[model samples]
Target chain A: MLKKYGIRKGFIAALFLNNSIDFISIFFALIEIGATPIPVNMAFRAIELDEIFSNADPHAVITEKDHLKVIMKYLSGRIVVERNGGNFLMRDSGAGGFGRGPAEVDHSIATINYTYRGYGYPLGAMVPHIQYLFGSELLQEAVRLDAGERLLVVLPMPHIFTLIGCIFLPLIYGITPVISRSRNPLRLFETVHAYQIQNILAVPELYELLYKFRDSAGDCTPLNAFLSGGSVMPDEMYGRLVDEFDVDLIHGYGLTEFTPVSRNIRGDIRPGTIGMVCDGLEYKIDPCDEFGFGEILIRTENMTKAYYRRSAESRDVFQNGWFRTGDIGRVEDGHLIFKREKKKTRKVKGNMVDLLEVQRILMEYPKMRNAIIECNDSILSAAVEIDSARNFDSEVLSIKKFLEDRIAGYKIPKIFSRI
Target chain B: MKDNKITTVDADNLRESIIKTLAVIARINEKEINDSILIKDELGIDSIMSLEIIANIEKRYNIQINEEDTMNITTVGEFIDYVIHIINKK
Candidate 1:
């Protein structure tokens, strides 16, 4: 079906789990035949969907029957894979068949992921061919994944980081990946126990839930390692996991732009550091004097070619052959330690304050379990969740008093809420 | 008696009903429960537990409690009264 539509050239494919497993199967089969697959996130709303499709301009879009009306309105000259029945149509394109052998082409742009909330950049990031190859190779070398390893992937497939690290990397090494459609905590644990999953790749939020389940279960089954990304892993939670489960918690730093950059390979892992850069990737810190933290610039063979259609916007960040990650980090003794990004910083009384620092400080209080520091241009506010049945007001007041002495009065949070 | 008046059920009866309802819903031990117990605090019942309790109580008693009635229930006594009021209605 793919070859008949001249989709032999690398193309983007849209897949929603409900109606498009057949399309996905065929898409993976195409990948085996050297056709690049662009997997779109099903979570995208109409406005966000239009922006991505307009920018990417994929050669073909494979969608389910339910999403056909909305997708067909925006896309033209494409192939539609219907999921309701076993009917496939190559719309506006001719010539179809399979197996023409692998085409030797430069792995320029393999896939494009759209960012959430349209915050950082319009098109999230592009994964080039070389980067995927190098990243998969680097992860394979670092993790020592065997063909018999059972990997539990808890994150959504559309997320670029999970796509490469958990899904593609495992496929590359011939490891079996157990993909669960449900995120229900009990069901997730059932899947783990049922499959005897040894390796897990998940976000910090899912890790927290799993930790609670493990505590309740009493008897602990050792997982090889828990790989976390997508958000900052709280230090206290990291410590608890190590103490209780005796499992090494590995952290990787990557975004939609650079799929998988750095990973804590050996179990001798640092809690807060993102570890060394992946092989075949070059990184440097942008100049900053205050905290020795700067924008992380990465130059790699796998860096995205360009923003699909936003040439002018792409040029702003992609300068002099290096892609500006907008993430702030400090290189400590050769390892890249990621701090909060500059955009997350706030200015008070002409003094700059890092929100992550405030969060870390609040997390130190015994009563507080989780904290998020949110700041607008003028005022900074904090939301904290405490252990069940604990009074958070006293803790919040104490934190405020402590900050008053250490930081400027203006830097202290103006409002605090128990969430 | 008024149509919506809850019958003055004794503590033993309330305790038996509550325990049976909770056990049926969550497969938890009902014998350990008491009238003075806080459903969440004493039982280590989280929000999911509360949701299951609400569903089971409605099905067993053939009664429906509004969101407002459930929100006001902080203690097991109040939860009993809330369920009785809904059951008495029908």
Candidate 2:
């Protein structure tokens, strides 16, 4: 079955897939045969996908029957979509010679997952096998997986955190991480009850939604704890999960480059802090302010050195083998308390909104002259400037409507200003 | 195009504007804000988003939306009706 498709030692395969068993199987198969699997986010629209397609030029793309058209529209390479049957997909891709014969592990690129750039282009962080070893070991111990662990997954497959926390770690730990396609809380509730899911991996945005649907799912579900990262979990939402459901809400912190740098340990929860640093990772606070708040710098064996094809940007962040996390935090009593971001980025409803990115996009609007975006109290505010002859006040709604077609909803600035 | 005088907002305009504001604030499509759809469940509008909608409503119409008016809004139609009523009084 693995006899085809010219799979070289460092073959970069872009996987445009949904959260299904097939997605997992293909990812493992790609790795088993010495091919680097790049997980492409399924939520991307044509414009965003165009940007990514240009950035990560892959050898091949493996998607599902539903997403074949979208993938084909952008990519001009060997494309494979899994049919309903298992053996069929294998025969199809293999007969096409997608696999580069016997798999051998050596010095080759492992995987490339993109990091969101608010102001700049998306960075494809290249991870090596050694980094994967450290990441897998760190996550397995941090998540506290048990032999009887049945994990529920709601996040996308392509994300670095999801790749480790949901996919790889479960495989290594000998557990099937139950993946759900729907983001609706009711569907998640059904999956949790049906599978008796004891561990769940999600982002803060979904956690907030689950908190809203707590009443309907409170008694029926069997979730022991939920491991969440990606955004700062609001203190109120955190307290509600703990107090209302008696659930262990673990807030782990790390970027797409590497994660589990720190996570709130079970039973020793801090509502606003990104828990104690994960074992095997060393963190240093480059003091930047008088209040002991500074840029969080981490040097871990598992960290990726440079962004794929982004040498300059990679050099900017990864200096002296320490990744400058652009986040401002203070260590208090063993917990890393995040103050604010040093970079012009903020979390709005759990999505990282880059102010510079927003401004750059804003400038593209026909009437837009210049703009400044700020995140105040988690509410995005944009001060837009236009040609003096045009009324900025009247263009506010139109500017926002224009943004709707371009950026995500959470990235939309709430307060519109004219300067 | 700019004016200091407050333009009279009719019921239809008020209703449309409020729904549009909710859609923008909640990050949902304007069509999703159908009259009877539960704002929280269907549109993913939480308490924070509702507050954002209220603030936007206030700012857009240049009127102070009292807490009682905001508390009464459940569905999109109800919210539009509430905003219209408040604007009429103002």
Candidate 3:
């Protein structure tokens, strides 16, 4: 099957797919054949998609037929492989072969997952196969989920949390990963009950909805543990999940650069803290303040050395064999207690929204002079300085309309004001 | 010109337009959207998508839908009706 598509060693393929068996199968197949697969965010619109293609420049794109209309223009001369049964429909734009395949082809790097640095464009984190192989085992030791247990995977698979915690970990640990298509709360409950899922690793936002829907529906489905990560789990929310739902909510922390940096121990659980750093990983708090809080730095064997195609930014984060997490925290009783992000980032619905990234895109507005985006009370709003000749009302609408096309709907600033 | 008042004819037209708009945003066939169809459960509209839908409607109609109004809407029919009401009030 891979032969027919001309997918060979060192071939770079972009997977623009949802959470399904096909996504996993394609990913594994690419890895098996020594190819690098980049899992694209399903929510990405044309502009986001274009930015990724421009950077990664994958030889081919594997996506469903529904997304064809949106990505057709970006295809250019690349191959488009549709996940349609036995007969794979491959579209070639007649611009010679696939593409100028990866020049050097560093075999150590497994997958290049795109992530934000709280500013500028997103950088692709080049993780190796060894990381998932080893990190999953470390995570398994912490979470302690047995093989054959059904693990509900409701989050988007492209993100590091879901990719590692849900997909890779399950695959490596021999656990059953049941991927849910929708983030709808009722549907999530339905999937949990229907599959008899014993475990779930999700973001805080889903847990919040599950609590709401579970309470309203009066569901009593049994589960082993609710593993929370991707974003900081509120102390109150953590308490509610454990006390109200009567379930153990295991909270952990990590980044796309490195998976499972730290995870709470199974028996020795803490409500707010991210718990001990994962075994085999080294962590240190640099520049400790008077209150004992500082930027958490992690050095792991499995961590990515540099961001792919981003030398300067990668150099900035990676220092002396340690990855600057950009997360402020302090060690309390040997547990890594997260304080707050030292970077210009905010979590909206558990997804990191880069304020600088938004501001950078806002500056692209032809009418705009300057823009500042900030999140207050969990609501993202932007204050802009535009030309005085332009009507404020029309410019706000135009800027929003411009942003809606570039970024995800959730990342869009809700309120706009002229400065 | 923006219409501040929606008459009976205007309301009907507006409702149809909203249904069409939502169908496109939700990526569902227009025929599939009905009164009983659950917005979140059936259409798979999350908080983000819901906000996007409201933003699109507000942009088109030049009207604002508050957070409270958004909370009150659950079904496709209710959302269409609420938008129509808001348009009428506008």
CA-lDDT, candidates in order:
0.63, 0.71, 0.78
Cα deviation at A37, candidate 3, in Å, is: 0.5
lDDT of candidate model 2 versus the reference:
0.71
CAPRI-style class, candidate 1:
incorrect
Which candidate, 1 or 3, would have the higher TM-score against the true structure?
3
- lDDT (tens digit, per residue) of candidate 3 on A1-419: 66478777887888877678888888889888888999988767665677788878887788877767767887777767876542357776666245566534589999989877775577888888788777788788888888899899887888878877888788778889988766555556667788888888888877876665454334545677998887778888888788666677888888888878888988989878998888888889998899899999999777888887878989999998999988999988878899788888777777777788788888988967888898885568899998767777656656766886677666778778878
Best by lDDT: 3
Kindly report the TM-score of the first chain in candidate 2. Answer: 0.86
In order, the TM-score of chain B in each prediction is: 0.69, 0.77, 0.83
lDDT of 1 by residue, A307-360 (tens): 655667578668888987777898776677887666545433223355765676
Over 4 Å off in model 2, which ranges?
Answer: A1-7, A46-50, A65-73, A77-108, A117-119, A387-417, B1-90
Candidate 1 TM-score, true structure as reference: 0.63
Please provide, for model 2 over B10-87, each residue's C-alpha lDDT reduced to its tens digit, 9 standing for 90 to 100. Answer: 666777777788778777788767788656434656445664565556556767666544554557777766766666
Expressed as tens digits, the lDDT of each residue in A91-196 for candidate 2 is 2433343433422223445777776645444677787766666776776675677876888888878777888888778877886788786665656777888888
Task: TM-score winner between 2 and 3, please give it.
Answer: 3
Candidate numbers sorted by DockQ from highest down: 1, 3, 2
The 10-residue segment with the lowest total lDDT in model 1 chain A: A95-104
| C-alpha RMSD of each candidate structure in angstroms | 13.1, 10.1, 8.5
DockQ values for all predictions? 0.06, 0.04, 0.06
TM-score of each: 0.63, 0.75, 0.82
Error of 3 at A407 (Å): 1.5
